[model samples]
Target: MSRPVVGYAPGAYDMFHIGHLRVLERARSECDLLIAGVATDAVVLSAKAKHPVIPFEQRLEIVSSIRYVDQAIADPHVDKYLTWQRIGFHVLFKGDDWRGTERAHEMESKLESVGVGIVYFPYTGDVSTTLLRTRLSVSE
Candidate 1:
């Protein structure tokens, strides 16, 4: 039997919420297997230069527990192309919030060369971890 299409999504996945669920739900629908890259705290800090409310280990555990995700892996580096190549994934999925931007457009071009496609799902604008954090701060 042929292996089912696998979709990979990489993120810090901290303080999981509706946005995270939406991405995973859409990814699962596009492919039989959905693999997630739970960015380590070190990686998140390197990019954002701030500590995540939830630590890497906790975030990894949270994402792994989600039923939609078939597998969760640590992503210490932010190299999207390399991760997709290493995992041999046929598609890389991300939120459309980054769509049409120079960086994402460039990435799309690069991935197309190697026969892998970049799929962008609609981004949930109103609800996000950032918004949740802000609300919590106000409540406190």
Candidate 2:
């Protein structure tokens, strides 16, 4: 029997929106099981240089409750290979915006070498937490 495909979709998931749901839905459709990794506040701060609008625990809770996510876990590492080592996922799901970046290339190389594949979903160009934040700030 073939092994079940375990997919991992990691994100900060702050200020949850339809775009996040669509990615999770698509990721779930392609895999037998979808594991969503919610980046902790510290991880977000370190990577993005700004604190998440929502707290880590709250963000985790929000992602965990998504119907498309079979499992939700805290993602504390900036390097996806480290997360792969810990989670042992068969595939990684990400937004296509990362498709051509250096970090994406590096991650693809490392994960592919270990027999893990990456699936880039079409990014929801109309919405994002950054855009929301910017709009809110401008209105205030």
Candidate 3:
């Protein structure tokens, strides 16, 4: 039997929007199964130094409800390779915005070392949770 193509995409899906939906949908199209990793509140705070406007539970619930995401997992770490170790996904999907950065290049090497391909999707224009939060703050 042919092996199923599994894909893993990780992010903090706070204040869900089309950008998030686009990535998940695009990721799903490339694999037989798509695993969306919802970053935990602590993980978000640690990595981004800001708490999510939507709580982790709500974020997971929103991500779970997305039709494109086959499954959702609570992501406790930022190490993509480690997530791949546990999930055994064949492809790792990341936003094209992260492409060409030093850290991204390093991450690509790590995933490649384990024979996992890295695919970068074009970042949606004009919308993101961070921008949403900033707009909300400005309006207030």
TM-score of each: 0.90, 0.98, 0.96
Say which candidate scores most in lDDT: 2
Model 3, 36-129: lDDT tens per residue? 9999999999978999889999999999999999999999977788888888999989889899988798889999999999999999869988
Ranking by TM-score: 2, 3, 1
Off by over 4 Å in 1: none
Query: Candidate 3 has which clashing residue pairs, if any?
Result: none
lDDT of 1 by residue, 1-140 (tens): 99789888888887899899989988999998899999888888886686799988889999999999999999877667777777878898999988988868777887788888789998899987778888999999
Worst 10 residues of 3 by lDDT: 77-86
lDDT of 3 at 100: 95
lDDT of 2: 0.95
Residue-level lDDT tens digits of model 2 in 1-140 = 99999999999999999999999999999999999999989899998899999999999999999999999999999889999999899999999989999989999999999999899999999999899999999999
Q: C-alpha displacement of 50 in model 3, angstroms?
A: 0.9
RMSD over all Cα atoms, model 3: 0.9
**TM-score, prediction 2:** 0.98
Please say which candidate is ahead in lDDT: 2 or 3. 2
Q: Give the candidate number with the greatest TM-score.
A: 2
Deviating ranges (above 4 Å) for candidate 2: none
Error of 3 at 57 (Å): 1.0
